[model samples]
Target: MKFLQIAAIAAALSALTFGCQKKAEKKASYPPTPATLVKAEGKSVRKYIDTLGTISSLHSVNIVPQVSGQIVKINFEQGQFVKEGDVLAEIDPRPYAAAVMQAEGNLRQAEAQLKIDALDVERNRKLAKDNYVDKQTFDSLLAKVEVDKGVVETCKAALETARINLDWCKIKSPISGKVGLYNINSGNVVAAGTSVITTIEQLDRLYVDFVVPSQRLYDVKRFMEANGGKAAVDVSYIEDDLGHRKTVAEVDIILNKIRYESGTAVLRGRLDNKDGLFWPNQPVKVRVNLEEIKGAVLIPNMCIQIGPKEPFVYIAAPYKDGVYVISQRDVGEGQLFDGGMRAVSGVKDGEMVVKSVSSLRLQAGPFVYAATPEGLIMGADSKPILDPAKMREFMSNATAIADELRAKFAKEAAEAAAKKQAPVEALKAAEKAAAGE
Candidate 1:
């Protein structure tokens, strides 16, 4: 009885296994999946190199006192826009003024002595000519006149020096720009040429400084030469969270010297910041356009699939019952393009490519159909109609695929027609014999 029970259990397990196998086989015979199809198209594209860079003021100046003095007045507030030669601060001018006066007094004394010496030389010359004075005395008087002229010139130089010192008392801006914070306040003593009073930077036009490998400098220069001594550059500020960049300006790029330590060359971009969108020393994204690809074949990056050795895409050909024959063609892929498109070499213009709903389910030569929204209709409820424009585009893609398939099989179609006609002619001859024709 125990042996009979074991035999019954084994029979029941065998029946269950057989039932599961039949169900799985039924599920595997379903129809092919549908996919979104798009066409490869030609577009104008540009090649660019992306790098990080720093924004800076094109022109910056450090304001310092040319002469040491106590600051008596401050003329500019921090962060004020100033013009060239605008007075910024005032130093005490009393000492310089006194020096000017003393030099002028010395100049007058020298002039007076020069006049007396000249008169004495003229009188001695006249006496020597009449033999009343010796030639040596006349020569001595002429030498005295020359010495007086030298004293006058020395006094004049002293006066000019004093005047320059007095001018320095009023510190002025050397360039037109916005001023930074003041380092010293009024009544503070500053050292000549060493103390930092403030800083001014020109912001109407800005510079973006970036570095790239030295090998790329040649490409930069070649691009510039082709595009009128300037390569196109874009400056952008990046948002860290979303990884998006906001372009601040489009500018021209200038190539600079290479640094041997890092084997990188510095590049400077001149950006017009008349709107003050960018700030100095701010980090930004820099993109330099190296070259342009004309008539480039472009397709969405999603359409490209990796094959055993190269990248490939699925070319869709129209098949029976609104389905497509997906054939894989190897492609040479280039740089990433705008709008998530990639440049490819193997595909021609206007070829339909499949967009997979689930990339993992996609494989070479898998059957597919065009996706539509007809299933949205329900009983006793209104459904959203297909967009007219989108429907037209879908129909157009189907027509294109059909046309391509027809052209590809044109020779075979002629051969099939000949075969069909030959059989029909044979039947006609047999019918004529029966009719005694």
Candidate 2:
């Protein structure tokens, strides 16, 4: 009896000792690595698709001499702007003038022969009626009259040709345009249709051609139709300024046909070159902004993490007085901001998101480190664009979270081990059953 009583007392003491032993002290809390903090900042975002293209003249033609001769005079100054009908070069017109006079003389001779034939035909007709001459002779005279008229017409055509050739000796501007340097200087003999004097390109109203991906055809067409007119599209043309793009002009026009192989299409806009701000054959960049989108929520680009296939972003929830939990979600993004993505869905326009990217650790909140403010990227006085080591520090803090989890559960782990159950299985079964219960 005394032995049983002593054993009972010992058991009570053992239970008391075990219960009184201090549980594993809670691990110290570290500031959470941010998943980049983002505020609900609303701003105007223009949706643009950009591509490179070359400038072309709306109307351009080459100046070539139509008549060949020794260039007696360079009528226009080299590289001068000339109006339509402006005489540019003077060729030696002596030979062509002589040809014109010869043609005129030949035409007069043909007309003289025609008059004689007509008189003979008329006299023979009168005499034949009175049997004053042979019937065959009168018939022959009538035939000669018809033949002479044809000859006269042929000579007239020759005269017209000679006159035209004479006029062509003075090379004239076909269109009002700026003429390029002379191909044939004065004193150089040139052949008709074989010499290129220069080029004349009309610069007043120019075709500003820009190419876009063929894949955009449907989107462009659909948007154009939805907008109810071609004018609904605004094309902003830009060029590099100090290594950055600045739009110099904006206009509206129709988009040309789609290219099948490359799946791209061209757009043209009218621009005035009176100020000589643009040049032909120069490269250009274009952005077609289809008016304002009715409702689109833009999220920060740092929030959108790009994976191999699909893109994703993390959302943080603050629950139960500082416990923050993070959940990952896929999002559709459009035109990128300087540092943010224009989120189409999976996030509301005014919702907060991770932007600075240091708080990815401690998904279950309470460890949020208030975000440090960031300003726009400044120039030469700018800070380094990137800091990897700083990011790594956050990543290390996030990783260190695993140790606290290990320490907090030391007693539970020992009890679970004594019960002879696998820790992984217990975790899964416990989580699954706990969720169900």
Best lDDT among the predictions, by candidate number:
1
Predictions in order: lDDT: 0.75, 0.63
lDDT (10s digit) by residue, model 2, range 1-437: 22223323433344446567666633344444433455455556666665675667778888788888999988777667889999888889999999999999999999999998898787778789999998898888989889899999999999999999999998888888788787878899998888887888886656667766777766666766776544222223353452242233433454556778877777666666675555678776655665465566777665677757768766655432222335566777677644545645667666666665543344333234334445222112223224567545544544354234223333444554457666777799989997996
Q: In model 1, where do residues sit more than 4 Å from their true spots?
A: 1-28, 213-215, 240-256, 260-263, 357-365, 372-437
Residue 116 local lDDT, model 2: 89
lDDT of 1 by residue, 288-345 (tens): 8889889999999988888789888878765754557677788999878658998999
The top-ranked prediction according to TM-score is 1
lDDT of 2 at 102: 97
Model 2 has a clash total of 18
**Could you tell me how far off, in angstroms, the CA of residue 284 lies in candidate 2 after the best superposition?**
0.2
Model 2 ranges with Cα > 4 A deviation: 1-27, 31-36, 40-47, 224-238, 242-272, 307-309, 317-326, 337-341, 359-369, 373-437
